[model samples]
Target: MRRHKEHSRRLPAGPRQTGPRALSGRLPGAVAVVAAAALALAGCSGSSSSSSSASATGSPQASGSPQVSGSPQASPTPGQQNGGTQLQDAYQTVIANVLPSVVQITTGESLGSGIVYDDKGDIVTNAHVVGTATTFTVTLANSTTALDATLVGSYPDSDLAVIKLSSPPSGLKPASFGDSSKVQLGQITLAMGSPLGLTSSVTQGIVSAVGRTVTEPQGPGSPGATIGNMVQTSAAINPGNSGGALTNLDSQVIGINTLAATEPQTNGAAAPGIGFAIPASTITNIANQLIKQGKVTNSGRAALGVTARTSFNQQFQPAGAVIVSVTPGGAAASAGLQAGDVITKIDDTQVDSLNALTTALASLTPGRNVTVTYTRGGTTKTVDVSLGELGTP
Candidate 1:
């Protein structure tokens, strides 16, 4: 089986994860030709392709910008025309209603996308987009005036953050978030973000799938968040699209665009149409907490409540995870687990390293009881442990 690679969507100076399962960043001036295939909506005939060359601003555009060659010229039936026109009108209406809520976020060191979360000027975006910076420059849609903003809080575990504009301008339209749990397969979704620093760019696609669990590569400027119940889409999520809005035909924000899959065989190039977004439920859950509490007080993620590292056997091979320090009165401590114990498994899953243990825990729910297998003083023992919630450090 081949392991999939994931890359965060911050453009320019973003970190890349390295190793057998590492993800690489798109170079600053990398050109990605987005092929615009002429759609055959409502029985329309003939197909044409337009090549968009990547510009310095990170937007890909055709040479003439608005021109296409070999334009399809097929007459459609009355029924076909009505269906196509209605769909077209829906797309236009949704874009107009939601695009203004999307904005371009610029940290001097990086660039990404954000969504206006409320009328108070709170903006929700990916944590990596802010990336160690407390201040930012935000540019709204259809406007060139740069606004100053400051970080309210960041929850890296969920890869979500909130920033407040120093002085929120009038007529700020907050996006209406939809219930991601109701998102269905094949439902049309539009991704709105600043890809490659191209502000107000939109891409169209369908909800390819839902309930996807993706762990981002951990490194500088990367949170390495193991996000569960993620929404996968066929939308093109290029660099700078992070923290943007993925909306439905009803103009409701369904998810926050986060990262795209990278192919190791292709030298870490982005695999087109395989992007993942943090669902609206997770976004609101985390973003609201950050805005109200200045810190995440209740992270819904599970953890074993112990600090550990990978242990090696006599041959220097990874044998198991050795507990370094047990959190006092925490899950491991309450379960009679002590430091220096080597954990080998959780239930039926083998855990030979810290990362493996983390991945295993990420899949389990907090407060769930599971059998833990570990070795202490050369004696292997099994104990029942109830997992605990993972909180922001």
Candidate 2:
């Protein structure tokens, strides 16, 4: 389907269409955000709202008449009384409890979703949803009033960010966060957000997978990075759904919807029933830091300390990572590494390309030291460097 972000910051291409990496639909004319996993993914920008069509009741009703059921109704069947009524009631209760916390975010020609993060007027959304703006216009659930908000901070590596309302809305209810560690496959979920600018919309599905090491392009024309321990779901994550809540039946925010599947080989056909989100455990930690410091000082994420790109050998096979620039006082710089060096491996893991390098590094935490193998001037070299923390204001 057609996805477009007509008036916002640049939209990144989602994962490669080969299912090795997928992009999500973002722009009014593009697919979702960039994604990786041998699984194609993208940022929200598609128009399809996924919902199971309700089956017809198969009974006729009187037109323009209030049918009063004064007569005693038949008791439900044993199966219906035990399973159907309980599930239906549970879903209704959760939806009612959670809808008030979801909100719509608009920034320069693009629209997306967010969730109320706290009673202090803080809101959590995707870094891309926050875009490059420090101020925003947010529409709360079931309300048309657009309130002013200020950006607290954003961390794109995990696709999470925080914004605060200028004036706290009275009776604001924050959604509770569930332990992502407790999330399991096949659990039911409700994806809430504004898709195509429709406020307070929801789609239902089940957890398709958990703890996936998924990566996406930071944005258009930037080096891609992984958002570790992702939550994959079958809920329809459409355009503008980014930063919205992937909630469990307990009305808890389990994840923040971020990416949708797109098949580029089919001219960017949206792959229904597949979407991704940033887990709540990561969201809580990053948001807390951003709100307090306006930047993350201890990201817990591993970084290479140098800008790098993939390079190939003479045989056109993936060889290693080529360093472009090293951060001053960073692990690579302290280790005396410089530009023009090709990294071939990290510890025992072979680094064949940029993606491989990202995967290897994501497996480690910040401050962890590992041996990096590289080739410079046709001479092989190794250096022990402590990985640095990523994330700036």
Candidate 3:
């Protein structure tokens, strides 16, 4: 498994630290701050003496009446209109439209939520969410009925998977996809999922950063690799949120909430406000492929069994996959690549770090010949190597 070093930074913990809570359709933290300031100015006017008398007189009986004679008064509360039920109305609207399409996914021993991609009942989630699941159960958001779902396809390297339900529930409203490429930093974002098995939890935050490359957990047959071009946000994401959607204010999903930074500090304390997600642009391509094909089709390229060190000067920076040994008769061996060689690039792309190389390789397919450039004996050399299918070892 990938071992991520948690960086310690103190930030405000989310309300009710048990995990993220269900949305009450109120303004997010940032928005609430602005709204509160506006309310302060409005409160300065104070209730007019005439308005106070009306309220104390016959208006009390009419206040509970559904029909009002005069123009409907504006809501006194910032988010409440006419009465305090407006917030609940908005919450119901969101829950009604989006909840049906969300499904609780159980794969292997892992469980996470997924959003329906299309009318065909195909559900998309993180590959890690369904990793190696021999069987799957999909539960609708509003109902307790669990339908059997079939594993359509999965790309572990990219951390994406698709499943098709044999009998999906009615009234499924697919989530609208948004452009991740246009997502701006500091824009408000929402995350909806079952964090710690609490269903329908919603958290809010702004886009923290973008283009982050996180290394996947180490697994059999493949070393830890980087997931490139991720969208980082301050939205709280927990274990069960791996496959949940990260949406914008309009409720259009822009990213798939996946990873979070939970590094312990040197003082042995956990930090907050660090989370990550897979961009929707990447999710769309991979999910479409999984729905059509059972597996991802890779352009074949040569395999060089080598790990990399982060820096040449440092004898011990276990960052990249260093070449401990070369597979005999493999592409790297045929290209005169030796065990001591340190790979620094693939084709023209610089790979000074292992994460960079892993990200580059993840974008390429097997059987395609690419230039393998490396440094050996303090000399850099380029060699043409044919790609091979992973797991051939």
Off by over 4 Å in 2: 1-77, 218-223, 315-318, 334-336
| lDDT per residue (tens digit) for residues 1-393 in model 3 | 332221111222223343222342466899777777877767864666447646655455644555343435733555554445764555456555665666778654456888889988898887767766646888777777778998888777667788888986677778888887789999877787877666777887889988876775554212344566788888888767768888876667888877766433224233456778888887887787677767665413224545445545566554233466777776677788877777877888877666677777766666778998877877878889877655322
Give all TM-scores, in the order shown.
0.80, 0.77, 0.64
lDDT at 168, model 2: 86
Worst 10 residues of 3 by lDDT: 4-13
Taking every candidate in turn, the Cα RMSD to the unseen true structure, in Å, is: 10.9, 10.5, 10.5
Which candidate leads the pack in lDDT? 1
Once fitted onto the true fold, the runs of candidate 3 whose alpha carbons sit more than 4 angstroms away are 1-96, 219-223, 266-270, 298-340, 345-353, 359-373, 382-393
Ranking by lDDT: 1, 2, 3
Which ranges in model 1 have alpha carbons more than 4 Å from their true place?
1-74, 314-317
Highest-scoring model, TM-score: 1
Q: What TM-score does structure 2 among the candidates reach?
A: 0.77
